[model samples]
Target: MIVTSYGKPAVVILSVEESERLKELDRRVLRLDEMDDAQLHEMIAAEIPPELRYRIEDIPETP
Candidate 1:
């Protein structure tokens, strides 16, 4: 939930599980942001190997 002050956002409230998940996502985004353009492109273009097929899972639903 969002808390507002004078028509502006002031604070956010999240469940413990939601907070932890957001923290992890933040960490991942930070790591990606640190990468250079070439590195980011390489990662984006990389193909998954057949050997790792068993590790793939369905995408998670957005909250």
Candidate 2:
């Protein structure tokens, strides 16, 4: 759960499984920082399911 104060996010509550997943993603992000752009994108795509993956051209950089 996300905790909000004064209409801004303050904290998050996560199950043990969710926390573990986030920790793993953090490690992946740290590793990604060392990869070249092409290799980084390839690894991200490979980890995500094909159907769930964003189309290269359809990805958004900003809200």
**Residue 33's lDDT in candidate 2:** 62
Q: 24 in model 1: Cα distance from truth in Å?
A: 1.3
Off by over 4 Å in 2: 30-33, 36-50, 53-63
Candidate 1: what lDDT? 0.84
Task: Give the winner by lDDT.
Answer: 1
* Per-model TM against the reference: 0.46, 0.46
Alpha-carbon deviation at 26 in model 2, angstroms: 1.7
> Residue 5 CA error for candidate 2 (Å)?
1.4
What is the C-alpha lDDT profile of model 2 across 1-63, one tens digit per residue? 889999999999999999999899987674656789998787767766678877779986863
